[model samples]
Target: MLTLTENASTIVKTLAAQAPGSDDTGLRISSTNEEHTAFSVGVADAPEPMDLVVESEGARVFLEPGAAVALDDKVLDATLDDRGSVSFAIGLAE
Candidate 1:
């Protein structure tokens, strides 16, 4: 399960809109053990393995099984800065 904020909502829309033609596109949020700390956006030629499709008010998030583990019980969100740009964050429940 996951939650989407307004800022995340906007980013989701932008990514979807960026897809080629009318092709369906959405956000894929994952947690990796690799030493990388950033989100990614791209077009997939086909469905990915162990991917969970999440949707909220026209926004979507694709999560891999392994990544979902770290995201479990965590609130996935996106927030806007003073510059009006958006960024993503995850919060674990206390």
Candidate 2:
């Protein structure tokens, strides 16, 4: 299963909380291509029926099948730039 770093967990929680509807809203990741080398991220009110739900440290991430497989042994991390922009990255889990 994919894991979230502390930075990623905090950032995801903040961003997801901004959505107006469900408290279960979370960050969603999906593969951009068949190779699963690229991913797109967004806030979703709920996971798709087939999505894999990953929760850590109060944060939740929904992953499509390809993305879930691709990221299975990875870690999600984030950083907030000086201008308030957030960037997300993936790394191998040790």
Candidate 3:
């Protein structure tokens, strides 16, 4: 199932507040390129549904449809020991 960590929720809340006239917002993560590889983030009034968790700087992230197929049942994690890095392990589908 998709999960958002405390830090991730904070980031999302902060970004949502930054949008003009947007009182409610969620991370709009989507896949890009025909390679079906790569993702991007932006503030949106709505966040696509998914069942994955992405960890970055102690924050958890959720993916939208465009990114779900590639990320389905994936456990993503990120760290900042020296530089920023994101890694993941694929999980079996339910």
List where candidate 2 sits over 4 angstroms from the true fold: none
Ranking by TM-score: 2, 1, 3
Give the alpha carbon lDDT tens digit for every residue of 5-91 in model 3: 444455555555667744334455677765547877665664445633454443335566657676655443323335533323233
Show pairs that collide, candidate 3: none
Compose the digit string of candidate 1's lDDT tens values, residues 58-84: 876777665665565666667777996
Question: Whole-model Cα lDDT per candidate?
Answer: 0.65, 0.97, 0.51
Which candidate number maximizes lDDT? 2
Q: Residues 7-88, candidate 2, lDDT per residue (tens digit)?
A: 9999999999888869889999999999999999999999999999999999999999999999999999999999999999
TM-score of each: 0.69, 0.98, 0.52
Clashing pairs in 2: none
Enumerate clash totals for all models, in the order shown. 0, 0, 0
> Worst ten-residue run, lDDT, model 2?
15-24
What is the overall TM-score of model 3 with all chains considered together? 0.52
| TM-score of structure candidate 2 | 0.98
